[model samples]
Target: MMFTISVPKPGLVRFSHDRTRCLQKFDRTNSVWSMKMEPKFSHNRKIEELSVELPAQPHPPHLESSRDRALQFNRGQPSDKDLDPDDVFEFGGYVAREAMCDEEYWTAAFLRAETHWEDRNRDRYVESHLRKYTDQEFNEIKKRRNVQFGNKCRCIVAMKKDSKDVKRPVLKSMVGTLDLRTRHLVGGETFPEERVKPSNFGSFRMTRSNRYGYIANLCVSKPARRQGVATNMLHFAIKQAKLDELERVYVHVERKNKTAQDLYKKMGFQMIERATPQLEEKQLYLLCLEI
Candidate 1:
């Protein structure tokens, strides 16, 4: 026997066939069925089928750019994106976004500064200043800094008081998370261990001559707060300045924050002998550490 079925709309349909005498036609569109039966109606075949059409969607430009940016960053490639060069300066580690790529491995080490050191430090910066750059720009800065420093530059991040993210850090005092590189001084008969600690920032107070030694926008993410991220950043800066043969390294702390003041003191930093320009009037302590 032979049978045929037709459907006008997209849906599920069931069909049955009897081979006793013969089979016929089933028309779902007209809700009609024709069957020819013979001596026995027990012999039959049944079938069911379903049909559907799906809709299509498009991707947005920003999301695509973000994805591409992440991939490029992961591969240590410079991403094509518009950015404010000054933002790189804020990190105090990257002179330009291009630095991160040349020394991506070292840059990756620097990223460890953000690990959850303390509860407070772990939650803050990631959503604020850290998030400002697409992954591409961030990697570029790391690459650029690495290349500029000849892969010897040490880097660190510190947070501001008014910063939206405030958390504890594992380093306990910002002194522990610093990346101290001796690459700059390697030419002077220095070994790996001795290169990490140079004598600078222990005596030099903030002065016009030393202003260039300081960079702005050092920060630790929320997870690594209170763990000495700030102090370690200071130590890293001092190490770099000393590597450049600078006489001393200086940093200005807001007068209101006793915690930072105490931390600097513990790190062998002294209050300025004389505050010039706006430092005294604004109550910013000019702390000097001799290296």
Candidate 2:
């Protein structure tokens, strides 16, 4: 038998008449080809197969960004779609929302300030303040029918979370607290204008009439102090004031506590020394910030 060979066209492939034979692979330049004989494939042979299809959906840009942020923050933990940055403010320690009836906010409020009172040697002053928080007195106070109007104390609380990886058991407790109330919400006499520094009272545009909110009881635990916790709380308060459409926030700082006064000053707060006619007239300062 003789065989004839010629160049194959682009669409044409040569085939041999012999059965049970197949062309495996071929290189044009070398004309090298290799093949291995195996059982032939029948036209009706059954075979297994697999395939997958994914459905696509369009997502808003903000939703994508929010999901990414949530994934990063939760770090493989479960999270809800409703979590928002504005709802929970945190820095060194987490600052939860306004206080509720759940935890002992009132008790922690007194305990946190005990150290300050002792350091100032104001034991008498501490006793005077404790008179209101007495067990019997607080019990009677809580039973009042008009408890809502009983006193104006708004506390924004901060808490430090316990670490899971620590070898020893950790205690999660209140680490910081702040109190605020609009001047109109509670009646009080503000310091005289002559005592306030003019430079510290820069003006901010007010959507509504200008009002001031009293910021009191701002404190952080010793361990959380000097971290960004205090700063975060102060800034968070200012942001809340802006949301309330208030023009300013006012706080009173004792003259003896120069450290806190300095911290306020660094946050752009102006001072107004008490002008009362007494030996301790200058014992306290009124710090004000224009939101």
Which candidate tops TM-score?
2
lDDT of 2 by residue, 1-291 (tens): 111122111212233373211121222221212333233311121111100110111111122333223322111111222234564576653554444321234334443334334345446665566434433322432242121211223456555543565221111355565666543311122432232333333322221343466676566656555666666777877776776556877776666767777788899999754445421453566678877
- lDDT per residue for candidate 1 within 129-235, as digits (tens), equals 32333344345444534323222233443322222253322112121223332222221212111212233212222222322233333444444445444555565
Backbone clashes in model 2, listed as residue pairs? none
- Residue 165, model 2: lDDT of 55
Candidate lDDT (C-alpha), each: 0.35, 0.44
After superposition, the stretches of candidate 2 with alpha carbons farther than 4 Å from their true spots are 1-84, 116-153, 162-171, 185-210, 273-282
Could you tell me how far off, in angstroms, the CA of residue 166 lies in candidate 1 after the best superposition? 27
